[model samples]
Target: MTTFAPPAGPVTGALPLPVRRRPGFSLEGPFYTSAEIFAEDIDRVFSSQWIFAGTEAEIPRTGDYLTVTFGHQSVIVIRDGDDVRAMHNVCRHRGTRLLDETCGTVGNIVCGYHKWTYRTNGELMFAPAQPPNFDKTCFALRSVHVRSLDGLIFICLAADPPADIDTVAGLVSPYLAPHGLKNAKVAARSEIVEHGNWKLVMENNRECYHCDNHPELICTFFPTYGYEPDEIPPNLLPAYDRFLAAENDLHAKCDAAGLPYEAIEELDGRDVGFRIQRESLDGAGESFSADGSAVCRRSLGGFTDKRLGRLSMHVQPNFWSHVLSDHAVVFSVLPLTVSTTVVRTTWLVDAEAEEGIDYDLDELTTVWNHTNEQDGEIVARAQLGVSSPAYEPGPYAPSEYQVEKFCSWYIDAMNAGEPRPEPAGRSTGESG
Candidate 1:
């Protein structure tokens, strides 16, 4: 039998617990800076929810595998035969970490500590010095709940994950299937560590109020996002009119292709909150380049038209993506500690598209690469300000509705006493 060490930190009694968060307002300072609340976030939010791990494109072969680590837990997402499986990355015998590398191909999972061996399917195959009565069947690697929705992978650490994901998958698959993300290949991937809590990173992404800081992105991405018709200020009305015209053109093209373009927003008031839509871009009304033209020569899913706009989707807790005609970009957030987080960005292009011939890697990734760097600086400054004793919860503007919804869902999950996993069925909850 193996014994594990306790967490390295002062006890909860030594610190001041966070105050209860108020609705329609920013979370209290402690919620972002306290060690106690950070641990609770890992338990109530990360562990209990289905997190976007990685895409199937990352593991196109049988032995391909990747390790996702967050809040002291690690999971191995691997491809075995025709199925994708997720297992806790811990040796069953002595509780040692089995795989330390971020990603690689492996015929079998072998523990470095004691040479315990397991198949790609997570079945225990060998244990060198076990008792005669020991049973290999009883020592199989523990499995984590994993599901793939149109090639995007999600994993839940809880024994009974939220069932609302099935309903979410059904509604969003039509918008995603046309892009062929499952068959796509990664063009570029990068990681940046930000000096902020995980929630701050997510909250920063929920609104475009600070988009002026992203000049590269604004060249193609309209600055009128997250605003309703009535809320459009006079300064942005002309841009709004341009957006309407481009939207009309996009709708006509989508109708001809039989693709879903209308928004389906249900940001809160359910087990799984999500929003998806295909919106028009500025300039040439295409990809993320400076002039809004196609970034790659080959189109995704064999679509001839480059003006398909972007199929954008946002999932609660931590996931968002933008699928364009020529390529797609996916973002995943992981917590490192109470005061830091890591954001991983991946760019995907057609599998047959050659890097130098069909697409320029720098041009394909320049927009988002610069945008992320700017966002990271903003989050860091926000963290610094909120750490001061003068900081207080502030009201959220109407244009920032999604941020409020995200905070509400998080607070609800934190306050939901114990796990009451929803039954397997579609949720009929009202849209937000």
Candidate 2:
């Protein structure tokens, strides 16, 4: 048995982190390759922020649970009776991890080390050979703060989680509600350990300047992703023209359905940074299939039109999603080490859609699966380059505005003593 222990203090003669980044530039090399900075990120940014954990579709029935482990922390997001709860995975008796599997169904959580048992609701159910005076109530599993914005689950390790999630939720729910994610079911989920810092993985996601590298994704996903109207280069003019026509058609559909299609971008200057919009896909203007047609026959949320476009949302510091008419795909980033991070992607479809009947599994997952592998390669290469001593912070192109916003949010969260502005109101416009 491999027993896990907390990490020791930093080694002597560690390089000091660059405290602040030059505005509108990439972060320094240490932010992507230093153990000390990685530890600080887990302690400050991830611990303090509201993290996107998973979806309610993950644990649908009582006793169903999913375990999320990042750095030295592990948490269980479980279904108990009618509610979903998050609790520390450590056992009260010997600090043994209660769950080993990434996800499964369990009648009771039993610590393998000492046989201590806990109920789905995290109540202490059994403790063998205990003193009669031992109070079980006092030893219930320590609960973590959890919130479900519609069907999307988020967890916070800190006791006092930021309240801006409520404000962000209010703005996005109108855009997301029509998709009816709560009623959807997990069609497929994949996890890959990318050889890169978590920050590198996120930075890679914030811009489409690298879209040419993703052949499969760029077929349906617009190549003009992060570019402003005036900033798109002549090389991408053809793609931009297609985007405009598809967007106009998408707006007509959204208006008829009363769905919010305008973007609500509030990426920085707040505790909960997010950007969401219902925009058009390329090809057939439907799902993410090779030909851009509906991957599933049944539309999620009872939409009759299969060409409803994609409702895309990106949330810092570690989540993003694309909701199509027939299906949705979600991504979560979890830091594993200074140089390795796990990216989990899940595909969701209508609950009634059967695997062989309504959708073929490979067709449903092909595009994003290829895109994720491409991204993993890009991040690993970036990590290798940044680890070299010659690497330095570089200027971000004007099209990479979201990447800059992400860096700004990260820096603000890392400064524990600094004061930040109130959560900003949602703006109805493109971020870049």
Candidate 3:
């Protein structure tokens, strides 16, 4: 197996620091306009990188299974007796998809075209009308690397394991473990199809630089742009701080507030932290602040660590996790064409938390879905505008560091000349 190397530090003069007294930016023209670049991206980026498949909670039983798409490939995650396995969702008989449904429990996966039976564990258990000399062992389902982190599931297409999932988990565990993600359950799921590139969706989610345009939906929750942790309401800050600042007393407060205790715990425990800094925009009509100090506001209010409310996180590339004190939601981005992307968002809650009793997830879902639709409209228009012959790559606001980080990461990965594996981490085991 080929051992994976962690990304190296920025070499001297390799990536120069951003220009001073002016915003700095770079845009590779072909990334958004060329079909060839898109194809290469699928192979080098999506296929190799860890892609969210599903949650282990989605398939709790021995025979439980879920079918999902990784890029254009069909894959299945199933429970096989005592082991959980991920395999290509293809029938050996005629290369047809074995299971067409999104999710379910099955005794055996039997192809509709021909009666080829495979155990839930992905072993070719039975095959009808095989020649006397036929060997079933060689025909077993093709296996893919699978691992679970918290409850999230991830799968990689490459034959050799790219990197240690545990290492990846260690990096983000401090941020996720406190939220009870390890034990969380799926409460609901929804999808949206947008008319823009997948990258556009990611860029939008990476920074909160465009929230005012849709204030009615976002301001109800996150009402301010101040970065001082104290400037925000205790309920608005992540939970970990409460644990440290107030001892365990905050845990009770969080529980009483209906927030996810573990998430807050993780946030507080994290070595590397996040801060929200904002700067008011002037009349120049730019969406961001002149100094890039502030982010755009949208439906900011949701859940926080204090209660099962709302919080948002961008997990590099095309995945996002939105945590509400009571529940959590995840989103995956799939690019269909240069100008089109399909987004799937799923809402998760504790299995015991009844929908209406604990919280109205649908209300939260409606708000977030609408927010996504609004983003779609804006990004689509942006795509059209950028495609104009007169357009030039503009400067990045200094405060828009998240956006800068994202663009820098993408460029670095592309320049590395190697396949990008799923962000190194264990899967949550849920398939969307």
Q: How well does each candidate superpose onto the true structure, as a TM-score?
A: 0.92, 0.92, 0.70
289-361 per-residue lDDT for model 2 (tens digits): 7778999999998999999888999999999999999999999999999999999999999999999999999
Candidates in order have lDDT scores of 0.88, 0.87, 0.57
- Compared with the true structure, model 1 gives a TM-score of 0.92
Which residue runs of candidate 2 sit more than 4 Å off their true CA positions? 1-18, 417-432
Model 3, 51-93: lDDT tens per residue? Answer: 6677776777777887766345778888775567899999887
Evaluated against the true structure, the overall lDDT of model 1 is 0.88
RMSD of each: 8.3, 9.1, 11.0
Ranking by TM-score, best first?
2, 1, 3
Q: TM-score of the candidate numbered 3? A: 0.70
lDDT (0-100) at residue 49 of candidate 3? 56
lDDT of 1 by residue, 265-382 (tens): 9988876788999999999988999999999999988999999999999988889999999999999998889889989888999999999999999999999999999999999999
